[model samples]
Target: MTQTVMHLDDTDSLERFDAALDALEGHLKRVFADDSAEADRAVLAALQEQVRVLTEERDRLLTDLEAERARVQRLKEANEEVSGRLEGVMGALKDMAPALQD
Candidate 1:
């Protein structure tokens, strides 16, 4: 059976992940309920492999999320520094405004 791959890159990723897990669990239950022992064993092995792959994907996504969060923090700090310097420059310009007017 061909399985569909879902990318978990958005805000609803957790929900999608849960749904995928549930689907896998349902399939496992159906396999156990089946009377064909050999076929069920094969299906079970395949399902186990899919679970392993999904777990690895989840770990990779978590690592990516951490890196993205760090990047955002760095950007925020840089933006604040730039904003402060711009405010200081504007204040200096205001101080020179009266002299220029006179």
Candidate 2:
């Protein structure tokens, strides 16, 4: 079995490379010119908009959650204050009960 090896000169190699690059560029242009490419771009734009909207919504929700947490803390503190005052009033009422009974 004999195998023949073929090699191109520098000029021929360069021409082949240029031709390959031109063919690739033409193919890419044709692909991008198709309707599907436009549809792909539109889909990408819609997805980006959705992501932006979702991010804004997430940030708003986080802000609302923080406000709710702060409100809960305030309510808890107010509840503790009210409970303390109620306990003092109950103790005073208990101390007066014996006098009222007499």
Best by TM-score: 1
lDDT (10s digit) by residue, model 2, range 1-102: 995534535346445655655565565557656866645777555655665565565566557656766876999999999999999999999999999999
Residue-wise C-alpha lDDT for candidate 1, range 47-84, written one tens digit per residue: 87887788788778778768877887999999999999
User: Per-prediction RMSD in angstroms?
Assistant: 7.0, 26.6
Measured with C-alpha atoms, the lDDT of residue 51 in candidate 2 is 54
TM-scores for candidates 1 onward, in order: 0.68, 0.62
Question: How far in Å is the alpha carbon of 82 misplaced in model 2?
Answer: 0.4
Q: Poorest 10 consecutive residues of model 1 by lDDT? A: 3-12
lDDT of each: 0.80, 0.68
Q: State the RMSD for candidate 2.
A: 26.6
Q: Give candidate 2's error at residue 95 in angstroms.
A: 0.7
lDDT of 1 at 46: 88
- Candidate 1 runs further than 4 Å off: 1-11, 22-38
